[model samples]
Target chain A: MELTAPDRHLIAALEGGLPLVARPYRELARGAGLDEAEVIDRLAAMVDGGLIKRLGVIVRHRELGYEANAMVVWDIADARVDDVGDRFGAFDFVTLCYRRPRRLPAWPYNLFCMIHGRQRQAVLARIDELGRVPGAAGAPREVLFSVRRFKQRGATRLGTAAAAEAAP
Target chain B: MTTFEKRLLDEFQRGFPLVERPFAAIADDLGVTEAEIIETLGRLRDEGMVSRVGAVFDPGAIGASTLAAMAVPPGRLDEVTALVNGFDEVNHNYEREHRINVWFVVTAPHRARLDAVIAEIGERTGLEVLDLPMQEAYHLDLGFPLQWN
Candidate 1:
């Protein structure tokens, strides 16, 4: 679905996030040149259409004292990848789960899940718990803990100044 | 953290009210005045604990995105990092503990735009860039409860 100009305006208004006012969407509607109802309707449709993956508060794990962010990759059987992925997703500790193509002879991980904890050992302990999940049991995996974050932000999106310069 | 702040963060990660007076609705539930709710959120944003109180778009839905990695020699890590981070398309760059040390996510409005950015990075760094696009993403709505152990 192609995004319209108004849609872009709404997205632009959302770049920094919702205003800290009671009627934030009204403020957004004003900036986007749409009424409050239309603004809410468009966003609702967008959410239903899967364009908006998540609609809520965005937290910074590091600032919240959950410093250990480990991307745990697993080499699960191809046939059971989704099943195992779902199983991994069930764990409260598994923050993000995905299935990606493996770069053969170099990288063998196809199932990746992220575990965030306040301590490295705590993250590891959760990973151990994750290992017991059905097909994930006894699976070969690797943990790539982030040493330093050079930059961390949400997706670079349309209508943002950054995206304008980056895309063009 | 105050108990109220902890509850607010834990409970409101997702399922944010999309109504016009969202903060008011939250205030009603949290037993605080609307102004207090808004003020606390403002303070959280200033402290960097709350990045935003808004929608998180599907990167590929609104545009093109990929997870790319590079194996930079330790001697030139800083230069390579700065070069990669310079691009607006490149968000969430991290140094992971592996031979493929540098990892980042690049998102753009089009596949060509994303490709060009990745290609340019490889050319400038003179290293083979691994373009690992996400094939599928699975999500679970766990509000990341603050484990106060």
Candidate 2:
């Protein structure tokens, strides 16, 4: 959908984010020349439309003192994938879970998940529990632990600054 | 597009100040009121154009695991997704254009358990689960300009 001027303005602002304040919405509304209710309404609509998936705090696991992390990939039977993926998603420690097409030659994972914890042991234990899950009884899986953080930031549309700068 | 949208994207990429009045601070810098900043964010969020506006973190900091993917059969996409998402450790899964179509990330506290989970998945799913542990992260930032129409 072609975003309206107001919509574009809103996206640009969100790309930056709300200021940390007691009443961030009210403050933002005033600056953007819109009412707080409008802002809320727009966000609600965007979320409903799937333009924006969710609005929440991006927890900095590292800053919060989480130390070790890894990525686990799974190849489950096509028939029982639902049963297995659902079981995987049910775990409290598991943070993310989704399905993607299995890559060949170079990669081969059909199902994916992310789990987090305070220590490597804790994370591993959770993975162990997933292993025992009846749904994933015969699925193949892989784990890629993060060695370093290359870059991290909340999602952003890259070239808005240049576009904004180039604007008259 | 208006200046508000431009500034929002630019400022967002740069970083948000972690202060008591972070929004107000941004407003002061941009010569706008804090309310404007919040409203704009709310609007963008509503429009389904952006995913999140919060802290970005290194998964490794917290004992977590992650991975990438390849082709999944067309027929069993939903089933595989359900099984994969079932794990709490699973986060950030997406379908990429490749032979190994299905890609996902998993994080666990320890290595042994992660392996066992992998083993279990192989046994249950009956697919060759290729474990591509991150040998070296050359570049890993997906946040990019969304101006490509």
Candidate 3:
């Protein structure tokens, strides 16, 4: 998108995210040399245009006292994916849900889900319950838990060299 | 456009520097004052070029299991979104570019309820749910630079 100068300025400013402040939007307006309303309106428009995915808090579950978490992949029947996906998406616990192309030979599961909780046992119990879901029954599944948090952050581009060097 | 903005965005992708005056440190490195950096970043946020500034963690690390997506017809999207948003577990949903549209992620206190919830949704919505799961996480991060020419 050919952004206007103001748009460019705003885009550049927001790329990092809102500064923790008493009035975040007001602070942003002062920085961008635009009024508070203009800053808010532009942001709202950007969100509406599908440029900004979401505006919300980014949290650390471990710090928040949630200890256990896992990625559950499901080999759901292609024909029934839509039906099962909706049911799964409605859950309050699942934070992210999406469909990605399954890499042949390396990947077989099409349906992926995430569960987080205070304890491993608690998360596992939820997995067992998922196994009993009529729509989820007979689906091949696997759970991959994070052994260590190498890195985590909101949307931004950084560490290209470090990441590329680490890639093998 | 300044390389300072790019650097800031890049630094934040993996994580923000946990410091007393992180912005000041960033400003010093970029040859700008802390006030200038803060002002610039605020403008970017107001413009909607950036979404948020915070942490992104691995669900598995925290005990969230069961992730999935459902495809809804264009007409029924609104009704379905309302239904999905009712759950506190559902952080957010997105409209993606694919055949199986209306992708959402669900985290649960445990896996059993996650499964049951999926089943319940299927039963309630009368839609055949495709349970696609992750086998291997290869190249998961999607952080890209803002190209300014």
lDDT by residue (B1-149, candidate 3, tens digit) is 46776676655554343344556766677788878766766666555444456433333432244445666787987777677665544554555434455555565544555677678777777765554444333222233232232
* lDDT of all predictions: 0.83, 0.55, 0.55
Q: Model 2 over residues A1-168: C-alpha lDDT tens digits?
A: 334445545654664555445555565566456777776666566655645543443333443345455567778876776677777776666666666555565555667677655577877877888889986756687765544332233322322433423322
Q: Which TM-score values does chain B get in all models?
A: 0.89, 0.77, 0.74
How many clashes in candidate 1?
0
Q: On a 0 to 1 DockQ scale, where is model 1?
A: 0.67
Winner of 1 and 3 under lDDT: 1
Error of 2 at A155 (Å): 1.6
- Flag the better candidate by DockQ, 2 or 3: 2
Q: Could you tell me the lDDT of residue A139 within candidate 2? A: 64
What does the lDDT read for residue A118 in candidate 3? Answer: 72
In candidate 2, what are the lDDT values of residues B14-52, reduced to their tens digit?
A: 344434455677778888888887776566555534434
Q: Distance from true position, residue A49, model 3, in Å?
A: 6.4
Cα lDDT tens digits for candidate 1, A1-168 = 667677877876786688898788999999778999989888888878877766778888888887888989899999999999888887777888988889987788899888888899988998998888888899899899988889876555663745543443
Model 2 chain A: lowest-lDDT 10 consecutive positions: A150-159
* Candidate 2 stretches greater than 4 Å from native: A1-5, A30-33, A46-54, A157-168, B1-149
DockQ of 2: 0.06
